[model samples]
Target chain A: MIGAIATAIIQATLVSAVYALIAIGFTMIFGVAGVLNLAHGALLMAGAYVYGIVVMRNIVPSMTYHPAVGVIAGIVVVAILSLLLYELLVRWVEDNVVITFLSTVILAVASTEFLVWIFGGQNIRISLIEGQFALANARVAYYEAIGFAVSWIAIALLWFYVTQTDDGRSILATSMSERGAQLTGVNIRMVRAKTWIIAGALAGLGGMFLGFDSGLSPLMWLNPLAVAFIAVVVGGIGSIKGSVAGAYLIGFIEQITVELIGNGFRGMPTLILLVGFLLFMPQGLFGREFAHE
Target chain B: MPVLQLEDVDVSYGKTQALRNVSLEVEEGEIVGVIGPNGAGKTTMLDSIAGYKEYSGSITYDGTEVSETSSGKLVNDGLVYCTEDRDLFPYFTVHENLQMGAQFRSDDGAVQESFDFVYDLFPRLDERRDQEAQTMSGGEQQMLALGRALMSDPDVLMLDEPTLGLAPVIIDDISEALERLQDEGLTILLVEQNSTFALRHAERLYLLEQGSIELSGTADELRDDDYIRDAYVGVT
Candidate 1:
C-alpha cells in the first residue's frame, strides 16, 4: 500500500507538469484574446503527428537527421498553423463570442477528419527517449523524465519573458487591460499573434510527450481537451496561476484514484471535481472579471 | 501652424450623430480647452483624435494623417491620450505602471530622465512606487495616470476630465503640475465638464453644445459672457 501511494505521488507529479503546460496555454488565450480556442486540442494532435511523421516515416530525407529535428519541426509547424488560423479566421470572428466558439468547434471537428485522411484510422506510435529507470519506489520512463525537465525549462523561460522583457510584458499588460496596453504603444494585433505562437509552442511540447504515452490518433485530442477544460474551469477563468494549481490538484487526484481503485476510474474523479467546483465555487480559486466590451 | 488640427470633423455612432461640422486647432506650446456638459461630444472629439472613434475629417497630428495610423502607432508618434477611464493595469505596481508608459520607447536615457521628471512631479507616486495601482486613492490614481503619460515624453497631451472626482486639495496638486508643464512649453488640448477648471488654465476655450461649437474666444471674453457664467460656471 505504501509502495502504491509512493508510485502514485511520482506519477502524479510527472503528469501534472505536462497538464500545467497545456492548461497554461489554454488559459492565457482566454485571458488575453477572450477566445476559448476549442481548436487547441486539434493543434495538440497536429504536433504529435508532425513529430511522428518526421521521425518515423521520414518522407523528407533531409529532415530525418536527429530526434531534436523532429521536435523543433513539430513545435514550429503547430505554431505556424495557429498563426494561420488567427490571421485567416479568428481575427474576423473574434468580436462575436458565439461565432468564434462555433468556428473553433467546427475547425476542431474538421481537423479530426483531416487527420484520419492523412494517417488513416490506425493508432500509430511515436517513440522518444525509451528505457525505464527506478526512482526510489517508482519505475519511471526516460520519456517522462525528459518531458518533466523540458516542461519546467519552458515554464521558466516563459516566466523570464513576461517578467523581464518588454515585449513579453506587453502580453501580460494586455491581458490585464487592453486599453492600457494601447495607451502604452502595445499593438493589439501584434500582441494577439505572439500569444497564439507561444500557446501553440506549449501545446506542441505537451502533445509530443503525450503521444509517447497513448500513441497518435485523430480523436486523441478529445481527452486532453476535456482535461484542459476541467483544469481551467476548476482553477479559475482568467488566472494562469490558478490553471497550474488546478492541474496539479487534478493530476494528483486522478493518479491516486487510479492507484487505489482501478485504471477504468482514472477520469471519474476529475469530472466530479469540475461539477463540484461549478456548483459550489463558480468564481473558481482566483477568478477575476476581465475588462472587455 | 497648429501642432494639431481638425478640419470640418464629423463623428457619429450608428444612426445618432455625436459631432457635426466640428472644427478646431491647437497651436504649438499653447493651452486650449473644449468645455461642455455631458453628451456634448467633448470626449468623442478626443477619442476621434486618439484613434478610438470614427471621424470624417482631416486630422493632422504632427504632420501625419490620424486616420491612416493605428492607435498604438500614434502613441509612438507622441500623441498620448490620458482618458477619463484611466485604463490602468490594476495588478501592476505604481512603478511598473510607469514603466509600461514608456515600454516601446527606444531612447534609454530619455526614458530614464522622464522617470526622474515624473517622480519629481508626483512625489506621492514616488512614495508608493511598490504599491499596486488598484489600491491607490482616486486622487493618487489620477496623478499616476498623468505621470504615466508624462513618462511617454509626449509632444502633445490631451487630458479628459482630470479633476472629475477629486477633492479641492487634490485639484490644487494637479493644477500646480499643469502650470509647471505649461511653463515647460508643452502643447495641450484640454477637455473638461468642469467649466471653472477649464477657464482657470485654458488661454483659448471652445464651448461645445449639441455636437457643435456653440462659442469660441479667449478665456476672459467667455468669462464675461452672461450665457457662459449662467450655464456652466454655476453648476460645475
Candidate 2:
C-alpha cells in the first residue's frame, strides 16, 4: 500500500506539470485580457496535430524533419494563431461577456470540425522518445520526464520575465489594475497581445505532451479543456499562481483516485474537489486581489 | 499660449450632465487649484483632463489636441495624473511602485535621480522600500501615490486630493514637498477638500459648485470672500 501511494505521488507530480502549463496560460489570459478563451483546448489540438504533421511527414510526404524542428513549428504556429484570434476576434467582442464567451465556444467547435475534416475521427499515434525508466518501483516513460522538465523550464522563464523585466512586469501590473497600468504609461493593448502569445506557446507545449501521452484525436481538446477550466476555477479564476497550485491539486487527486480505486474513476474525484472549492473556498489559495479597475 | 486649456468642455453620464460647458486654463509654472463641495464635479474635471473619461469640446496640451489621446500616451507625453483612488499596484513593493512611475523614461541618470528625489520627499517610503503598497497605512499609501506621480517627471502634474485623510504631520510633509515643488517651477493642478491647504498652495483658485465655476481668482483675491470662508474654509 505504501509503495503504491509513493508511486502514485511520483506520477501525479509529472502529470501536474503539464496541467500547470495549460492552466497557467488559461488563467493569465483571463486575468489580463478578461477573455475566458474557451478555444484554449483548440489551440492545444492545433499544437498536437501541427507537431504530428511535421514530425511524422505523413501529410506532406517530403517534409520529414527533426522532432525539435517540429516542436518549434508547433509552438510558433500556435502563437501566431493565438495572436490572430486576439487581434481579429477577441479584441472586437471582449467587452461583451456573453458574445466573447459564445464566440470562443464557437471557435472551438469550428476547430473540431476542421480537424475532423483533415485527420478524421480516428486516434493517430505520434512517435516520441522511446525509453522507460523506474520511479518509485513503477515504470515511467522518459517522455513524461522530458515533458515535465520542459514545462518547468518554460514556467521558470515566464516567472523571471514577469518579476525581473519591466516589459514583462507590465502584464502583471495591468492584471492588478488597468487604470494604474495606464497611469504608469504601461500600454494595456500591447500587454494583452503579448499575454495571448504566451498563452499559445504554453498551450502548444502542454497539448503536444498530452497527445504524446495518449494518442492524437480531433476531440482530444475536450478533456484537457475541462481540466484547465476546473483547475482555473479551483485555483481561483484570475490568478496565475493559484492556477498552478490548483492544477497540482487536481492532478494529484485524480492520480490518487485512479491509484487507489480504479481507472474508471480517474476524473471523478476532481469533480468533487472542484465543487468543494466552489462552495467553501471560491477564491482558492491565490485568488485574493485578482481583480482590476 | 497656456500650457493646458479646456474650452467648453462637457461631460455626461447617461442622462445627467456632469460638467456643463466648463472652460479653464493653466499657464506654465502655476499651481492651479479646483475646490468644491462633496458632490461638485472637481474630480470629474480632473478625470476628463486625464483622459479617464470621454468628453466633448477641445482640450489642448502643449499645442496638441488631447481628446483623442489615450491615458497611457498622455502620461508618456508628460501629462501625468495622480488619481484620487491612489491606484498603486497593491502587491508591489514600495520600490517597485516608484520604479513603475519612471519605467518608460530613457535616461538612467534621471531615473536614478527620481528614485533619490522620491526617497528624500517621503523617508517613510525609504524606510519601507521593500514593503507592499496594500499593507501600508492610508497616509503612507497617499505619500507613495504622490511619489509615484513625481517619478513620472511631469510637465503638468494633475493631483486629486493628495491630503484627503491624513494626520496633520503627514500633511505638513506633503505641504513642504509641494512648496518645494512649486519653488522648482513645477506646474500643478491640485484638487483638494482642505480649503486652507489649497489656498496656501495654489496661486490661482476656482470655486466649483453644482458642476460649474462659482468664483475664480488669485488666492489673495478669494481669501476674504464671505462665501468661500463660510462654505469651505470654516473661518470667521
How close is every model to the real structure, measured as TM-score?
Answer: 0.96, 0.96
Please give the distance, in angstroms, between residue B231's alpha carbon in candidate 1 and its true position after superposition. Answer: 1.4
Clashing pairs in 1: none
* Model 1 per-residue lDDT tens digits across residues A1-293: 77777788999999988888888888888888999999999988888888988887533445454678888988999989988888999999998999999999999999999988977878988888779999878899998988899988998898898877788888888988999999888998999999999989989888888898889989988888888888988888767778888888888999988888889999999999999989998767877655333
Which runs of model 2 end up more than 4 angstroms from their true locations?
Answer: A1-6
Error of 1 at B5 (Å): 0.9
Q: Which ten residues in a row have the lowest lDDT in candidate 2 chain A?
A: A284-293
RMSD of each: 1.8, 1.8
Model 1 per-residue lDDT tens digits across residues B1-236: 88899988999999989999999999989899999999999999999999888899788898787998988888988889999999888878999899999999878999999999999999999999999999999999999999999888898999999999999999999999999999999988999998999999999999999899999999999999999999999854
Provide the DockQ value for model 2: 0.75
- Prediction-by-prediction clash tally: 0, 0
What digit string (tens of lDDT, one per residue) describes model 2 on residues A1-293? Answer: 77777789888999999999999989999988788999999998899888899888565678778889888988999998999999999999999999999999999999989888987889988756788998778778988998899999999999998887888888988888888888999998999999999999999999898888987898899888989999998888878788888899988988988877998999888888888888898877787645754
Q: After aligning candidate 1 to the native by TM-score, how far in Å is the CA of B24 from where it should be?
A: 1.2
